[model samples]
Target: MRPLVLLDVDGVLNPIGRRPPGYRRYRCVVEGVTYVVSLDPRHGRRLLGLAEATGAELVWATTWEEHANDWIAPRIGLPSLPVVAVNADTLPVSGHGEMFKTPAVAAYAGLRPFVWFDDQVWAEDEEYLRVHQGVGDFLLVHVDPAHGLTSDHLGMAKEWLTLTGFSQGS
Candidate 1:
């Protein structure tokens, strides 16, 4: 079984900042609010290349949810991808201080190995995975919100894919 690649939008693809060099600004309306997100044009190609190299399924794990396919995907040249449904009643709800997406991502991953790319992932989330999900089968990559996903991060994902034995096609 191919490992799942869970992708977050806010910090993973669309970085948070005053628009760094090479990043383009895009306005998207979600829930009646207009949000301006910074997206690096290269990210799409890199992510797609990663998927091709690892033969992993790229799944959306962002708050944008289905809107990711509608808005962000085309902007970055990605085809439609499976989205992990996250709701208020889900295990990752607020007030727990744990990342609202941690449990949801884990649950979505099920027994399949997964690699989660998010900006908000912290040590506590890692601890939760260590205790509840064990270690080797999963990877939680915490991206810097200011820098977004860099070449180093992609390198890490590729390395994880290789280390986890997910690398087969490329």
Candidate 2:
């Protein structure tokens, strides 16, 4: 089975603050909420390349939910991808300091190895995935809200994908 690359939009593809030069900006309204986002088109190509090299599937794990396909993907030159159902704006309600989406993400991943990219992922979230029963290998990439996803983050995911025995299969 192919591993999964879980993508977060707000802080991964779209920066929460100042972005690298030449990023395309968009004013999006989802469910009556306005969001102004900045995205580098190059990120789409890079993410696609990483998926191809690792025989992984790119899945959305953002709170943008289904709107990622409509508002986020095309802005960054990516196609619509499967989304992990996550509750938005929710704090760590489990009391273990884990993000609210942890349980849902773990369920979606099941036995598949996954690389998660998000600004919010913390050590606690990693531990939650690590200790999840019947869970597969996972890499939590903490993206900077200020800088967004970088080559360094992608490199880490690439390395971990190899370590997880990823095969570039047709």
Candidate 3:
């Protein structure tokens, strides 16, 4: 079975700083709040290549939504992939509510295993993963702000793909 790889934008693909040798942090004002960002472009390309080589379906799992297709995909050399938009219907009662993209992702993935790359998975994610353990497999991958996709993260993805009997020829 093919696995889906959910890509996050902010901290994963686009960092708050420059790439590689000149990795530095910078502040950016988005919407109204200022955010500290830093992502490596090289790592983003590597991830795109890995996705292509592994036959994993890419899905946008960022708050940027469709904008990720326009702004982020180009830098990474990936065309438009599917997107899991945030559900605004569920209102948050406290300090920042959960935007569970899992439902949308699950719908898109069907019975396929999926890997979620985001900086925002919380208690809801844990609960969801617990309940749907057998229906569809989910892997939560956390990317560091300073270092893009680490060896460990890529290794995990590689292992999953191999274990599931997925080929690199999608």
Candidate 4:
């Protein structure tokens, strides 16, 4: 089976603060509230390219959930993908500053190899991955919340996929 690519919204595809050079600000009204989301069109294309190159399945791992398909995906030109449902109440607190989503992410990944992209993942999460999810190839990428996802990050993911020999039908 191909590896799964777990994608985050804020911090990964969307950054906070001033827009970066390649990004464009888009305003949308959801439930009568106007919100502006900064996104890079290239990111969607690059992500799609990466999935094709690596034969990984892209999935929504953000709080946005199905809303990502309703709103964000169209803006960035991405097709709808599977969503990893997470509930805050059931989140595991390790007292190690590990992200609350860590356990949920791991559960969603199950025994499948996956690449996780998020801004809040920390050392504790890494430790958990090492101890628990170490049986298979997994890459956790921390994207800067202020900058969002970049070409360099994408390249690194591609390189890791290549280095790990995780190709199509693997």
Ranking by TM-score: 2, 1, 4, 3
Candidate 1, residues 92-144, lDDT tens digits: the string is 45344567777777678877777889999888877766666533478889999
lDDT of 3 by residue, 103-122 (tens): 55555666777777776666
10 residues in a row with least lDDT, candidate 1: 88-97
Which candidate ranks first by TM-score, i.e. highest? 2
Clashing pairs in model 1, backbone N/Cα/C closer than 3 A: none
**Candidate with the greatest lDDT versus the true structure:** 2
Error of 4 at 48 (Å): 0.5
TM-score computed on alpha carbons, candidate 2: 0.93
List ranges where model 1 is wrong by over 4 Å. Answer: 88-97, 133-136
Go through the candidates in order and give the C-alpha RMSD of each one to the true structure: 2.2, 2.0, 4.5, 2.1
Model 4 RMSD, rounded to 1 decimal: 2.1
Pairs of residues at least 3 apart in sequence or in different chains that clash in candidate 3: 15-38, 15-39, 16-37, 16-38, 17-38
- Provide TM-scores for the models: 0.90, 0.93, 0.71, 0.90
Overall local distance difference test of candidate 1: 0.82
